[model samples]
Target: MSEKMQLVIDGDSVAFKQSAGFEFRLNLSEFPDLVKAHLAKVKPTANTKSTQACESLGAEVLEKDFEWEFLKPFIRDVCRWGGFALIYAKVLNEK
Candidate 1:
């Protein structure tokens, strides 16, 4: 192939009273390894605000509640496809 490609990863994590989940979306990018959404584009597509119903939360709590069983394989595949492990992960807690 004579062409190069770029990638962007968009991730969202939401925490509820007793459960939390994360979704990551990727698209072909015009910038290399773009990992964040712009200020105007940063919004949760999921109905997390209403569901959370919490004034504040913590990463440790969300991490404890997140589904690592599914997240591990997804992270593994992303790493394999990217041919490197330059991932920045954070537990998303809201206030």
Candidate 2:
């Protein structure tokens, strides 16, 4: 649950120390930029028609790969995962 995550705030810095060493860190000065960036990336949940399209593919494709540089910052915001995501629905727009 999101409630269990550790939110570390010291002076002007903000760092979220999440489970499994996944953390999101940002300085107080970066608040405006962080808000702007992630807001631009935020998206609404997928519709039913699109969810069905994801059935054709599975998580097996990514199960064997590991990229720390990308994963490091990515894990903090990776919700819908119970610590790990071995399978996920690839939401797509209806054709």
Best by lDDT: 2
Q: For candidate 2, lDDT tens digit of each residue in 3-95?
A: 467999989999998678888888999998976775566443442212222222223224425354433323322423222333223321110
lDDT, candidate 2, at 9: 97
Segments of candidate 2 deviating more than 4 angstroms: 1-3, 41-95
The runs of at least 3 residues in candidate 1 whose Cα sits more than 4 Å from the true structure, single-residue gaps closed, are 1-66, 85-95
Clashing pairs in 1: none
Best by TM-score: 2
Residue 37 lDDT in model 2? 76
The lowest-lDDT stretch of 10 consecutive residues in candidate 2 is 86-95
Q: What is the C-alpha local distance difference test score of candidate 1?
A: 0.35
